[model samples]
Target: MEINQWLNSAWFWVGIVLFIVIIRDIFIQKSHTITHNFPVVGHIRYWLEQIGPELRQYIVANNREELPFNRQERSWIYASSKNENNLQGFGTDQDFNSPGYIFIKNAMMGYNPPVNHPSKKNPGVLPATKVIGLFHNRKRPFRPYSVINISGMSYGSLSAKAVESLNKGAQLAGCYHNTGEGSLSPYHQFGADVILNIGTAYFGVRELDGTFSMDKLKQKVDENPQLRAIELKLSQGAKPGKGGMLPASKINQEIADIRHIPMGKDAISPAFHAQFSNIPEMVDFIESMATETGLPVGVKSAIGKLEQWEELAAYMAKTGKGPDFITIDGGEGGTGAAPHAFADHVSMPFTFAFAKVYQIFQRHDLTDKIFFIASGKLGFPEKALLAFAMGADSINIAREAMMSIGCIQAQKCHTNHCPTGIATSNKWLQAGIDVTLKSERYYRYHYTLVKEIAEITHACGYEHPCQMTMDDIELSMGDNNRTMTLSKAYGYHKTAIAYEYFNELIDCPHLGGANARNRLSR
Candidate 1:
């Protein structure tokens, strides 16, 4: 009787339930191949696979060992935004002896003496604000309210909440937010300065016939007193010499209405502009747009083929008709969606491209007339300082800004399933983002970055960032344990034979060098 009672207990029922579940998982579940082979044990593999990314980030991956962005980089951005303890306990995790290492040369005597300075005890100091587009010929050339501003991230590519947060942040930061090619939405009118970017698709300024509409452009500029400039997007770094596609699934009625395209259809941007094909036509288009907008009109491009740029510069010099500013996007720049090939192996990197473009414009004596905005992985102050030293009038921050607004770098931006509520249009995901809170983070991040730039400039003995020259930075060639100043690296030295070391051979006309070899081969 005792044996019978024990067998009929609750434990007997639980055992039976477990056995049934195991049997079903091992035999009945055909969807999972591993589960069929390993029975209940196979479920462990599925759970581990589900948590693999998180596991790597939290445990397996070290702070300095990650791609695109390391833990240290992300932590700095986050800590600076929150005003938290960002200082590391020990020294830097950087490999100082590594090849291709770059660093700024601090001066023994800074611009202002430490003895008389109020913040002598402190490590950071504020530098004078640098003005951009001052010499440009425009009815209202942008003075650049801030040297660091938000880069182009489209409305449709980002959620509405994200756009509003960014716009508000721009307002708080006293900077400008670029209205990307996705067209202008009401959320963009958050009392912030705006830059209207017109792409091949001509989103906001397109007519029913799919050509650029001057009337619409004029209306937008006239209505928005805060619309500071207009940027004509010839190409971006992510996909140079290629167009973009917005899948129908991502496009809603509001997006369709804004873009002036039908809903539930793949919105295609052509590879090249329809308004102009040749160089002369393109120049004419920019001049016409500047005249219509009365705001500084600029062209944004990713560097490719130095000869093509030379031709453009030469023509602009000849006609004196060109953009008031030029934004150079490096190949490493990020995009919401792009083809793998184009993103990986298309355009020149930022530092090299920036140096080449600056040399070309300087050679043509057009540098004084046009402003240069550099972008591509320039999230850190060191990188921005490098750009300023390389002749960039200003720098644009894109991916880092996204991180400030709560992007987890999931790399799922192409899909609408972004978990962070940033690169997604899904309502459920977007709900996770609190605009008010995130906007504060954006403000803090921008403030910290601008402050850091000033601090670095002061440390380098410069009164302002604009005063930073290539001479202030040094690059490790990693060949023969050699070091070269940025001026020497970019061939800005006084010596005539300095051109031999430059990568842009077209600019170097000296005989018996690589230029001569090219001529002989041709």
Candidate 2:
């Protein structure tokens, strides 16, 4: 018989039947629920809910609001973030066809000012070191503003070129670049005056065997005295309690070594640290790191439940073991690859968090001991002023800076195929980014914006940008009916809180569960 005839025989039919029976026995039979119920294995639903959706919504871009970003806003950031030419036609990609589409006229009443001295001016100067808190008067003794700094950004998530470019920009701008929880990269070493951020993973500075390494941490920081600060990243705005995750594709020899991990596998930072369990214990670890390294230390976090913040604050107040600075990331953070649920459902938007933390610090009267740096969309002159008004000692802008360097605001940061070369890690793509060229825009954006904000402070009748307070102006109506005045809008000045506040009181859903007061009592 031919091949078909042979295969169609009884024995062949029996063989196929046997294979199906075996597969059914092994996999499709039953006990799938049992297999899934194994601790984190069952947590698929939770993970999917937290991060998966936001990522999808942002990537899909169906609606006008960019989900995570608005279309026009994202475009503006991408264009200005990069150091490339701002090339476009008819002003924007916005459709004039739509009835609701609003456009600015060339002869608009306002005089748009040009940047006078983009890179020529001297950097802002104040004191040799920053002093936090002016809570007390000093006929005998009081306090001052602290030289707080920015926290880390993972080298793995960010391109080597991007990180280098940021380092140059930060150094010129007299700020610190954080070496995010993915651990420190050798590239970060070049920007040596960094704040060595020991993220939850303890990725870098770990021994070859995967334990924490004091020698490595010290060696790295000690070598560069400019690496003047340290921050223990407890959590982040994108997904708090959720640690760092590096896909196998992004993990390379350099990353593996810096993070002290094996090759050929994605690195997952455990949600819980092996060393510390509770908030107090976490503080102890940060204190240990700071003491061990002889540098000012702090923790980075997306503010959580109020009980935790109060307990930690109370404990720190009791023990005098608080970190030097508290870097507060509002929930509206994490532009990189993150689960939608985490970004949307879990995180606290920065405006509220920053204000809450400021209140908490004042409540504990710890404002002088610790400083606050606000992240999460801290861009645009207007936005920065708002952050300052909300009591953020320093403001940071990642996506905004990306705009100055010629980003088109694609918001496709997770894809290494970032057309602007601001987010991708591909070697060939990275090679094309000339740090020298990008640095100019970064410098220009920082200087120009600072000046613009300073102008706002002056317009509002203040001394410096830092002096821009809540009592300055009134909120007016939008062209339609959408406007909130300054005094009535931003919690009504630093000392005047119209409502109750807590740093860690996050409502995963706006509907609410735990109240801020409840958390404090707990």
lDDT on C-alpha atoms for all candidate structures: 0.78, 0.59
**Any idea how many clashes model 2 has?**
40
Candidate 1 lDDT over residue span 1-522, tens digit each:
998998889998888887886899886877988887876678888999988887888789999888678888999999987777767887878876566467898888777635844235323222113223345467765555567888898888988999999999877766678888887788788977788889999987887557889999899889887788888998999998888898898888888878778766898888889999988998889888888877778899999889878988899899888777889999985855678888888999998888888888788888766778989989788888888888777788888998988988887888888899899899999999999999989988887887777777878896557668788888887756778888988787211111111122223322111122233222
Residues 225-298 of candidate 2 have per-residue lDDT tens digits of: 55556777777887887766678898888888878899988787876677788877787776667667766676
Residue runs of model 2 more than 4 Å from their true location after superposition: 1-129, 132-151, 473-522
Count the clashes in each prediction.
Answer: 0, 40
List clashing residue pairs in candidate 1.
none
TM-score of 2: 0.69
State, as a TM-score between 0 and 1, how close model 1 is to the true structure. 0.84
Highest-TM-score candidate: 1
